[model samples]
Target: MVLPRNRDYFQIFLASLSPMIFVVLLLAELGLEWVYSLSIITLCYLASFIFWFKNGTKPAAWISKGKLHIRDGVFGTDVIYKDRLESMRYEIGHKRAVAGSNAEEAEMHILVIKMKGFDEWTLPIKDLIEHGPNLRLYKFIRDNFYNLKLVKK
Candidate 1:
C-alpha cells in the first residue's frame, strides 16, 4: 500500500531559523556592550538549531493490509500490530475548576488505546502533528482501523 507524505519543508526551515531570529532580537535589545548576553544567545541558538534539525518536520505513516503498522519517531519507527490494540477512543477535555482560577479549562484531544494484555497507551494528536496537513494521518488511522474498540468511562 502507498503512504502519503506529510513533510512540510517550509515549517522545518522556519523552525530551524527560529533560534537565529531570537538571538538577533536579543542582541539588538542588549547591545554589543553586553558580550555575555551575546554569548548566551549564541549558545541558545545553536542548541535550538540542532534540536529542530533533528526532530522537526518528520511525518508519521500508518498502513494496514493483514496487520496494522504505525511508523513514527525521531530516532526510530514504532510498529504496532492490529491484534495488540484492545480499544481506541477519542478523548475530549472536560471543564474543570483549577486552583486560583475562575474559569473552567479543557484538556487536549487524545487517542487512548489499550493494548491487549498490556497497559493502556495515550497518543496526543496535537503533539504528534508537525503541520496542518499531517492531520490527515490521524483521520486515516481512525477511519481504517475497524477493529478499534472504544473504552467506556
Candidate 2:
C-alpha cells in the first residue's frame, strides 16, 4: 500500500509566518504608519508562501514490490530492498515553538530505517498541527515486513 506524505505546506507556511501577519495587523490597527515595514514583511511572506506552495506536497515514502521507496530529502528519493534493511524503528520528538510566543511546542513522530550498507533514513510521519503520528503506517510496516528487525529507538 502507498501512504501519502502527511504534511500540508500551506498550513506550515502560515504558522511559521503568523507572527509577521500579526505584526501587520497590529500596525494597521495603529493607523498604518509602519507601511514600509508592513509591506516588506507582507511581501516576504507572500514570496515564501509561493515558493513552498510550489515545492511542497512531496517527500512520500511507501513499500511496494518488497522494496521501500522513501524520500531522502527535499528533492531526492532512495530505494532499499527488503533484503538490505537492517532494522526499522520509530520515536517521538518535540519541536520547539517560537520563543516568547504563545505557541506551544509540537510533537513530532519520526520513522527511522537502517540499512546494511547505508546510513539510517528518517522520515517525519507526523509534524506540526497538520496531522498526527501515522501509527497505521508503522503498524503496516511491522506487520507486513515481519522478517525485518524491529528495533527500539
Error of 1 at 92 (Å): 4.3
Candidate 2, residues 72-150, lDDT tens digits: the string is: 4345565657887787775655464546878776555666778798899976644333224455445656666534343
Give the poorly placed runs of model 2, Cα more than 4 Å off: 7-13, 19-39, 59-83, 89-114, 117-134, 140-153
Across residues 104-139, which tens digit of lDDT does each residue of candidate 1 receive? 553334567787998888765443343124345445
Error at 105, model 2, angstroms:
10
Error of 1 at 142 (Å): 3.4
Best by lDDT: 2
Candidate 2: residue pairs that collide: none
Candidate 1 deviant stretches above 4 angstroms: 1-7, 21-54, 63-79, 92-107, 119-121, 128-135, 143-146, 149-153
- The local lDDT score (0 to 100) that residue 137 gets in candidate 2 is 48
**All candidates' TM-scores?**
0.49, 0.43
lDDT of each: 0.57, 0.61
Of candidate 2, the 10-residue stretch with the lowest lDDT total is 125-134
Clashing pairs in 1: none
- In terms of lDDT, model 1 sits at 0.57
Mind sharing the TM-score for model 1? 0.49
